[model samples]
Target: MQPTEGERRTRLTIGVVAARSGRLAKLGDPLTFVTEHLRRRLRHVVGQGGRYELELVSRDSRSDPEVARRVTEELIRHERADIIVTLAGTRVLPAVADVCEALATPCVTSAFPWQVHYFGRGATRTRPFSWTYHFCWGLDDIAAVFAEMWAVLGAERRVGCLWNDGPQGNWSRHRERGFLPAAAARGHFLVDPGGYREPATAFDDHITAFRDADVEIITSAATGADLARFRHQAARRGLRPRLITCSRWLAYPVDGTGADDPAEAKVASLVYWTPRHPYRSSFDGMPAADLAAAYERATGRQWLQPLGLAHALFEVAVHALATADDPTQARAVAAAIGRTRLETVAGPLDWTTGPVPNVATVRLAGGQWKRGTRHPHELAVVSNSHCPGLRLEADLEFLH
Candidate 1:
């Protein structure tokens, strides 16, 4: 609703919490980029009408849940924020989401799967609270992309679960969660040894068990440091799997400089928002490739995967605000968010027709790190089972 001539401008505050600094520095400051890009968009939007303008309040989670929760409370209580958003993996997002639920505040979150929050909190079939909305690839997408990539590989199906204590790792090892069920649906079985913690000096026991089990494939969702450590240990332990498809580890650039073994050549990963996918931004009609290019040009660092998903959060917020009759009313804004079905930079997000209430997912595709003909190294899109029409650039190659 447009304000009358005498009506005052409504100030919309968006509180964004993320791991802006700390050990997670290598991952890049995703939320900061999202907030900056959103500020540009919101400025153009508010220029259209002086009725409402955005004021984004950002907080650094320091990659800590306690900090995330504290910042969330500060946003709801002190900042009097009309809406809140968070960006990170399972560690920070769920805690902030919990605070939003407690305060009955409308919040949007991303960078982690809905299954992580759902099953981690012991949510059953019944819909729980309804204040927060989450969107990201669930384990189902990971399993699908992995399974499809395996099929294309045409190798032995013996799968080894290289699980850490992370959300994706924890779920993949649990029978009741999305990973195994999705794998079963895809006609695959997993060889799970057990869960391991990160920063371990050795993976001898884990590798020995997988080798004994005759596992040809290894999949994991561990931290980059852990995976790198594991990679070094696997080389030393003589654990060679035909296919090694992992997430998180391959998400960022590791200073390879001669550290990588030849086995690392054909590593496959779950690529959620590759520029090859035909997705367009709601802000400026820029496609994924163009948006990624702009990000890299603006910042010398590589564009992160979370950047696209981060943008989706703002898309949800803007949609909710525009759709609400009175955006100032938190409940009205929350209700509007619940009804969002917009085509965002990530893809088409329809929260209303959800597989789970208050959750929407953009499909994923498989990608492989291959020796680049153009560049030194590149991740080529390989499987498009989940995201159809996404062009594949290379065939799946055996890593070991």
Candidate 2:
């Protein structure tokens, strides 16, 4: 005999692809915390006059593109995941997005800029994606926020750049629409060393050029390892600038940086989300500060920005599941994701109003790492020109 209307139940599976072990492992730290928090919250979601049971299965990408694709395929084919979620950078996120798009599975992600996800995936205005949707700030937002921070510091107009030849670097070095144009609008000159491939061991040539040009402000979006190598080499050559700002660096607790390192003091990056963000989670109405404090207390580690981004990723996923009348249908879930417009811990996300059909932009502020009274090091909001409502916590400090 068929079950009664009140007894009817639907099971929804969510597959997660993250950089759990490898160079980018730091980016995956929040997944465990956020998923544990959601286990109870998502035990049963009431919608469509019936109850839905949710299960989450996670796979580590190991920070490799090939591994990301393989695990995503397994989740879709073997695990029968109704939806997929990933939080990573251009390298691994794009790999997962490609698999979802080809397999016609729905996916949501953040952490990297929208430009890298949209353009790097060969998506154009005429040819848009249907299965993958992303939410994050763009390169232009980073340019505006970084320029504002530099101006506040009264730094010299000459700025040295060290962008790698990745998707982020290629777009950031674009003359007409990249970071330079926005900085130039603020009367700052970028001394670009041009793009170079990763695994580049030495930067003697770039250092000499910057020293010759008397560049006092340095900026880049290189990977954490590459950035560390460049900084070490630059220091040996006595090329320390008054300010060093590296995008995508402040988002995670990478080795030799973040809360435990005093040597990283005064290094700056663009801020995506923070405990101070004036927003609350749609899941349990938990404020951003409370969520961050809980993570710190539970893990016995400093709160990183990915905690908020990762939590908000689930917020969107659960919202999509709840809104879809038929949670088992991929089309229904994808439609709900496309129509998502809810307030989350990372701030409000509206897919209908993004610059592109598959992307939603987030607000950004300029921040610097400083010695903290609470933690070994803490990220301080130094400029909020792009995010006027985010309170400025401190003035931009010079490394000199």
The TM-score measured for candidate 2 stands at 0.92
Clashes of each: 0, 0
TM-score for each of the candidates: 0.91, 0.92
* Candidate 1, residue 131: how far the Cα is off, in Å: 0.8
lDDT of each: 0.75, 0.83
Cα lDDT of model 2 by residue, 1-400, tens digit: 2336665446778898878799778788787678777777778666554777788889989989999999999999988887899887677889999999999999999988787788778888778898999999888888888887777657447889898877888888777657778778788888887777887799888899899999988888876677778878888899988887889677765445552252353578878788889989997789999999989898898788888889988889888888886777798889989999989999989999898898888899888877678875678888886775799898788876
lDDT tens readout by residue for model 1, 301-371: 66667778877888788778777767777888888888888998889999888778788887888888766
| Weakest lDDT window of 10 consecutive positions for candidate 2 | 254-263
